[model samples]
Target: MFTRPASDEYIRYQNQYISIVPEGNIIELLERQQDDTVNYFSSLNEQQALYRYAAGKWSLKEVLGHIADTEAIMSYRLLRIARGDRTALPGFEQDDYIEPASFDTLSNEELLERYTSIRRSSLSLLRTLPITAPARRGIVNNHEMSVNALAYVIAGHELHHMNIIRERYNA
Candidate 1:
């Protein structure tokens, strides 16, 4: 149960890509997010989950699949950086990842299942990381980022997409 420290403006500004969940139970917060995401999808029908804001944008199913893929990628980066690997990690373009029209065939239940499974794997990986690993730094997407920073970025990314799904797609 790693507890996140209180947010300082300087640190927040430095790690602009991350989210700041309250201190004293960051793992719980992550797990809470996992549960909330499950509930969020549970309430939606396939039509709702598959709704798209525009012709070019991703539908809700594609969005969920994208989240799962991104989580896997971020977790892999976290694992490598935490293990002291100094390799420069690559970044992904979400738009490119979500394209190709393959995800349109997936159902809401399948998307949710994928999201849940990927999250479980990520959580397991995070739980086993040594404390010192969080401080290790690495280059990702041509920017310097710490292992801990990547964790927060993972959480924030999901929140960011979910917000869009709610407000824009009405899902």
Candidate 2:
């Protein structure tokens, strides 16, 4: 079984992401997330996909794209750390990524396709790592964190966004 990362594995503020992850094998959790997200978002109509709860909030399509984007970033970070790279990765600004990507222009199918493909690549990467990979650490946005912690953070970040998509977007 893949071990769950300890509290010391990540930053304090990151609990908002990691704390919600249910106990399980991290790889299985990721696969379940991939299936659940593809199934849930696939049912939305274009109207629902474009819905934004407030004028300034992201539309559901953007939310979905953001999830994919974050997963890709986290997965890259995990890959690097798991492979023993000590590179200090830069942090991304969420707002800086949105409008520039033009996620609002894509078909729901296109958005979900991007998500599915990225997630598949992530799973392939995760499956190859040595068991010792989880303990590997690297600097991200200036803070050191473990590969295991980043894996959970990726899943928790999606859960956080999915909650908003459910409650506020009402889809």
Candidate 3:
């Protein structure tokens, strides 16, 4: 199993996400999060899901969509790096993706189902990777990081947003 990534393995700013991830098996932590996040968001009604705490901020539904989109992106990065691809990858602007998605237009059940499928796919990919995959490195958006670091980023990013949903949106 992949261990916690060292600080140098990822971008400096991404450390915020990594920092909140408690010590444990990475796969287990991700599995737990996959279940917990789905359940948490599923509990919200339309009004609660539609909540946006401030002007220009994302609604809770948008935030959930962002989380899934980010995971899909990060997981693709992980796949390339783990498979020994050395091609330099590019970064995506979250805002650009969010608006077109129109997450608020979709039902909560639809959003939750999509998130569940993506998380399951992520876990399946993680389980199938070779042992050395974690140490493999690649350039992503002009920065180099390890596949393992991407895994942590995925987990940590979810936590970061969920914490915000709880504290900021209060949904």
Candidate with the greatest lDDT versus the true structure: 3
Tens digits of per-residue lDDT for model 1 on 1-171? 243423431134434446434454556667998998899888888777767799878777888888888888988888888888888888777778777746778887778888898898888888888877777777777666777776776787787777888799865
Candidate 1 vs candidate 3: the TM-score winner is 3
Scored against the true structure, residue 50 in model 2 reaches a CA lDDT of: 90
Give the TM-score comparing model 2 with the true structure, all chains together: 0.96
Residue 42, candidate 1: Cα error in Å is 1.8
- Which residue pairs overlap in candidate 3's backbone? none
Model 3, C-alpha of 38: deviation from truth (Å): 1.2
Residue-level lDDT of model 3, residues 1-171, one tens digit each, is: 587889889999899999999899889999999888988988899878998999999999999999999999999999999999999999889999998999999999989988888889999999999888899999998899999999999999999999998898864
Write down the lDDT of every candidate, Cα atoms only: 0.74, 0.88, 0.92
TM-score of every candidate: 0.85, 0.96, 0.97
The whole-model C-alpha lDDT of candidate 3 against the native structure comes to 0.92
Error of 2 at 154 (Å): 0.9
Cα RMSD, model 1: 3.2
At residue 171, candidate 2 shows an lDDT of 59
| Candidate 3 ranges with C-alpha deviation above 4 Å | none
